[model samples]
Target: MHLRRERSRKLIETFKASLTSFACEACGVDMEAIYGPLGAGYIEAHHRIPVAQLEPGQTTRLADLAAVCANCHRILHRNGLMSVEDLAAHLRARRGWPLAAEPRPEDWQGPDKG
Candidate 1:
């Protein structure tokens, strides 16, 4: 039973990764964009439906999942019951940022190119 659940989880994660953008869905933070090549392909997959609410043998839909960076994912789970959208909204409001702010080149400068 446990093995089956684990395998199903993996399958869902794989499917989400294939369909979703490599950037964090909530903040659009791509690993490579921030951490450079070493961070490429590094992201966390979040299940939209809390695992506790899922019943055995229930079907997990791709839409019910999200790809997020570590920081955003952590914030999503901080209160133990925060939705992705809620977290995103809270962050945006607090930071006074646009919902889908694009990263500016000047925003990600490497060490002084002097």
Candidate 2:
């Protein structure tokens, strides 16, 4: 499995700006963009299913990834672990932000999904 963790540049910036401008889905508090070890205001866009776990020839889609914060990301991948969706739902429920309903799951263009 490739361990290289790379992020889409434009997507990273957009996510940071979105998080900053938007309130936290879990706390309703404004959150600032957190940088990865690389120093960019981004964590990592994670797929609920790892690429290594997918069928051959499968590639990641833009909508397939979630812009999770560091703690959520850690909880996701820790212990060989849980699905990103589970973490997302936990975060959503924790903050009581709209993550499902009203906005279609596929139509989620950002935090409005709550």
Candidate 3:
């Protein structure tokens, strides 16, 4: 159990460190842009596959994680682990925006760059 916790922690840290921008994957909320220096590189990781649902001996990779803001994270959990794509769609629909194709992470240059 201890080893599992340590591995999980390291994986999350590595995943966060891999990001070039800490913007929320679902809503594009850039914490640094919104809160300045204090929020630089700030983001919470969400499991694409809920941890509770993982099969025994299953492993998680960085690609299995999504960076999300606090509100979006809460909404995801509250809504039964709704997918990141689904949440983004819901937000777009709520704002009366068209559902355009989402850019891949590597192609996304963050809000300021675009």
Candidate achieving the largest TM-score: 3
| lDDT, model 1, position 50 | 78
Q: TM-score of predicted model 3?
A: 0.81
Tens-place lDDT digits, model 1, residues 3-51: 7679767876677558535777766667776677798888777888876
Ranking by lDDT: 3, 1, 2
TM-score of each: 0.76, 0.47, 0.81
lDDT of 3 at 3: 88
Which residue window of length 10 is worst by lDDT in model 3?
99-108
Cα lDDT tens digits, model 3, 7-114, are 999999999989987878777767666667898888999999987678999988899999998989999999878999999888767654443233333333456643
User: What lDDT is reached at residue 27 by model 3?
Assistant: 74
Model 2 stretches astray by more than 4 angstroms: 1-41, 91-114
lDDT, candidate 1, at 61:
72
| Whole-model lDDT per candidate | 0.71, 0.48, 0.79
Please state every model's RMSD to the true fold in angstroms. 2.8, 9.5, 5.6
Off by over 4 Å in 3: 96-114
Error at 70, model 3, angstroms: 0.9
